[model samples]
Target: MDSAGGTLYLKDEDIKLVINPGSIEEGKKIQISLENIWDKTSDPVLNKFETIVSPTVRCGPPGTVFKKHCILSFPYNAVNEEWWEFTLLVKENFQDEWRRIKLGSDDKDIHFYLHNGQCVVNLIHFTNVTLLGYTINIMKAARRVKFGVFGKHSLNKYQLRVRTWNSESNMEVTEDAKLFGEKLVEMATHIDLLYEDLVVRVQDVNNGWQISEASKTQTFSADDLWTKIPWRVFKFTRSDPPSDVLEATISSSQATNVFQLKISCETRQENIRSKVHFWYFISALTVVVIGLIIAWTFDNFQAFLTSHSGIALFLSGLIVALITYSIMWKLVKSATPAQIVACVFLNMSLYYLGVWMCFGFVHPLTTVNIIIILSVYIIAFLVAVVLFGEIVLKFVPFIGLLGSVIFIKLMS
Candidate 1:
């Protein structure tokens, strides 16, 4: 047996044969083997010389079809002597049944039909007899390939999977292929998803903190033979736990492939509450500073100021409470409308306190005293306007009210 040329020769005691290479490809190896015949139903003499030729062929990759042709040959004497018959069988795998290559009318005795008896049975006109080897064409099928991120979390872990299936059916088929490598992080800290020619940004939406430049991204490619998509790991700052929703954008060149993933952050409530409390304390300190400045500058009017100290202290406390509530409302995510109303009421009280203090300090109406009192009033008004612009307008009504009260009290 010649493996590369698909030729065979048998000169054993029981058989004398020769197989010539027909249309077999040059330098291509075809597998050949012999088997014993045990079935009594078959002809004993003909079955003794049976031989099998097996060759493994592949249809080109993913989306193509290819055809291959070959031929088998035998000794011319075997046909004339009638000692045995040859059977040519081909199969793709051991589990499949062998397909017989049928004999065609092209088979003829080269010596008897052309040169007459001048050539003996062994000395045929043609060196070897030929049989048509079956021609098989295989078509490669196309499949739909899908890639996506399966699961992701703030822990900086992501799982990715790729699936391929026949475009016309729901069944999934395996493909022995690979996906190209890509860099998901550019310049280290910025995590990005680039797929199908589009780039999507992964953002830390829950916590207000931006992803730090020192953070790193890790990627894991799929180990499965079929799925080759890569998963990305993004490390965000964990000093403050993530917010209620952690979001990232997934986009592709095609608009239909764009989507977003939102994951819940279970550990964010405590962090939010702490921030609210901290801002509230800051607002309270701001109010106390304003109150002390007012008290210290009015030392010359201590006797008169002491008489109204009760109202002054009550108004100062009201201003502090309003400032704290407003700050908390802005900082806390769970604040209610009732808390907003309370903040508004406290702001109105602060405005009234500003008007009352303005009148109390300017009552004597001396030029020197007016300069000092007006300067303090201007400073407090600017602070309120800068820090709490939304509630600062409540002081407008107090301006008119103060005028009426001061005129009546001083004239009477």
Candidate 2:
């Protein structure tokens, strides 16, 4: 908290951090990592007598001590009945030994409480926390489990979330979901039904789909060393431990899943882009070709850049080539390597050809003239070889430029 008495609260999903005023020296904003570490399900304490109810939530830099008391929350699942009999476990600085803390009276400074399906802890300092307890199994509690796909799959196929929930009626669950637009109600506290109930062996009707992921590491600065963040695709189920969800994973290695990647871009912007590439290939190639024609004609017919017509042509070529390059970058949809290569070469040839026409001044010793001529031949050769290759569209512009080049040279 700052001197202004503004409440400082940082939260992601369910993990929360609320710093009171003067918790860590006055007026100092410290670096915190609540979302940096990956979620874990196993620990040494569980091997003794405790049953793991939820995946371990990790926060860091280990051994961070707070001057004043601060409030922190941990999300938990009711693995079985008697969920109230949970004991909070704290692991400080990645030590082998773990400390057990019970939920005590709030009158004291260091007590925990259950609120809205999460355990709130007010302590001086921390790193990691886990909930441990056992519950009685009730077979009658089983309900119909349903799954739904969330997020725009076409735009971003790399990573997507598949939400699996258990309930009786679809209509009731959906009507209940409408209350929170971007939040999951599965973790909310209830009067009767507990949120941590697991629906085992939920089958995915959609076959041949995989939940694949690559983790990413965020570097706040070049100096601070941080661990690599691997992409995780966990099945964030509403109820119970991950044991049921883990069994559901098929080809995927982790708890995450992925749909296959396609060859072409699937953005809604593709329709407009498809129409433009054809015209752009033609127009960009023509402008550079026109510039080359003007430049070479000026070089041979008149002193280069001396005449008003020559200067205007040179400026036009430079400006239009620049504009074409700018427009090419604006087309931000996912593109094939072939398309990327073609665009790069087209833009390069544009600026290169714009100025390359001056080789007439130094004697055309198989200079740019021969290069453009060979380019046209190569394009023609590819058209003949591939019959209908993608390059054919991008290279068609070279043919037009070839015509202009030949016409201008002949006239000169």
Candidate 3:
């Protein structure tokens, strides 16, 4: 062989050859020759021979900081029958001189050792290792690395491992690594299914608060995947009403996860018209009962007139004026408090006079007197029903007793 740019010939029986390109300096000429040694009992050494078989390295998803186990397999045919020693080297893409990776139990990350004719390593805490003389922060940008597997018989193979953030396996590795990728895809599919099955519901505990029914019980699907649910505001008339705390729970029929949220509900408005009607009925019933009691107590007018003629004449005239005013108010269709009171008084007074004429003027204990009292009571009840609607008619007896007490106090 010439020291510089020379060609060499090899025989078919040759087992090994070594070339040193660095020894040939620039502008130098040298010739080389080889001679075979014929030893009687010594076997031929094939330490310089290169093995064609390469070791396979399988890793998990790339670009992930999470710890993962990587498998390394060496072909059984490539290994020596007795024993074989090899060194694994790794370096970042932009780095020079691959660093020797230690093989022992003391390593916390990136550990590789032979096990059952294959290399196994846990790259859980693996990071780019800095060269002893270099000062650059290579680990920060080290996403890819070149690994070298070297054997004693000059057998070596260099492979590249690229870090990826996705579950896709870019390297042609072991069957186990492919299965791990499939599992990642399956987990993601399940999460998507659970999200599609989620259901949301909103309830109105207070009827006074007005909320749109369309906003309640909203359903979400995978198409509307949201990290945060949309906020729904309560609407009301006049002013913002008092709020009640509301709870929202989100659960999927197919998932075990449960999420909860809280909402505030504004108070509802009151029905003013209904309230006013209720009070008006009470006032009308009170007036009716008071008028009936006054009429009943003054039925024996002649006896009272004889004792206190001046007072009896004044009260009798006042009662007559009130009855006339009540009749006129009703004809005008005026629904003022005073008008209602007057109408109630007139109706009860007319009933009382009819009863007094039939019963008090004759024998009070007779069957005809009892019949007249019953008929007067029936007529008074009918009048009350017409004036206040049936809601107040049921309380007539109670109202009468209450009004009688008030009338007695006034008379005294």
Candidate 4:
């Protein structure tokens, strides 16, 4: 082996293995026995080998042809007056090609590198050991970078962890945890670079995590979702969410401690439009029936008016019943099954009484006509109830009472 070149050749009886140089620091040659070497597996060290550096290891076992001792060379320029020494343990899962140590006049800087799926530590203690690069993974919208306690449990109190926020689109740098949970605040606080279309940021409070994802086009409201969704954290993985959305409307109201938020994202827009169109179609058909009645009245105007006040009364009552039931069901909770049944009977009975009084009692023409026409107005009101009442009921608690008050106030 060349002494000046920082090379060491290992030999065991008749067999030999050549060790190579790395770029980071100065290399050294050492003499040791293969039998006395650390088993590496049983006393597995942390960051001391390539396979174990990563939390998840996909690699296999170590080879058996290693030399008892070997020489190493430093690829990078050596620092002045520094002596290189071999360490038994190195950082875990390190696969770098070179391994070197920096030494001072009185003290040596501990060098770490992974080899043979193990962390080889040459010394028990050394000073001025600096770690070059470390990494962790994160997801987009993941709000927390917690320390002192790791994962969902506190098992890894002193364990250092680093993770990035991963969105379906991108990933960003995050915190690092370490020794006895010290230096945790520094490790947990992180702000990632903003991306092209999506900008993501995270905050770690004493108790919780907050993540905000904003888009170039728009930002949706995320109020009160903490209670609705089971998770305290949220991650958006897709550039575009996959869901069937028909229609979307945004509205807000206040009740109790929480503000009521209404957002509708329908799976099929056409379906909603079809339902609305059907209602309008029914309304138009009713208008046509009214037109027919008017035409017949014009032909035998006086005779028809005199004889069919009863029919007019019946039609008016039917209309009122439809509208009232529809409105009550949509807007108020008080529109119960019993109330609905009672309302229907009352309206029908009123119609019969109005008609009988118009003919049997020879009531005044204006009184009889007014009663009949009023019944028609009642029916039209019911139709209106069916059209708009249902939509209002979802937002109005105590449905009918609230709806009625609001409607009357608004109308007046």
Output the number of the TM-score-best candidate: 2
Model with the higher TM-score, candidate 2 or 4: 2
Better of 1 and 4 by lDDT: 1
Clashes of 1: 0
Candidate 1 clashing pairs? none
Clashes within 3 Å, all models in order: 0, 11, 5, 55
How far residue 168's Cα lies from its native spot in candidate 2, in Å, is 25
Q: Given candidate 1, what's the lDDT at residue 104?
A: 29
Alpha carbon RMSD to native, model 2: 14.4
lDDT of 1 by residue, 283-310 (tens): 4555445545544554354664566644
CA error at residue 19 for candidate 3, angstroms: 42
2 against 3, candidate with superior lDDT: 2
Q: Per-residue lDDT for 301-332 in model 4, tens only?
A: 46644666536644654465456545443422
Give per-model TM-scores: 0.27, 0.35, 0.17, 0.19
Ranking by TM-score: 2, 1, 4, 3
lDDT, candidate 4, residue 172? 12
Runs in model 3 deviating more than 4 A are 1-121, 124-195, 223-241, 244-412
Candidates in order: C-alpha RMSD to true structure: 27.0, 14.4, 34.8, 22.6
After superposition, the stretches of candidate 1 with alpha carbons farther than 4 Å from their true spots are 1-196, 199-262, 266-272, 286-294, 299-301, 309-311, 314-316, 319-331, 335-350, 353-412
lDDT of 2 by residue, 1-412 (tens): 3422223233433567676667777676666655323333225434322344433555555677777777777565453334335677777666457667765644343567777666787767755766665333332121112344222222112222333432212333344345422223122122122223222222331322233232211111111101111111223221211121111221111122122211211224354355446665566667575656555545445665575545754564456445554555354244433444465456545544553454444444356665865486546545543675333434434543444455445535
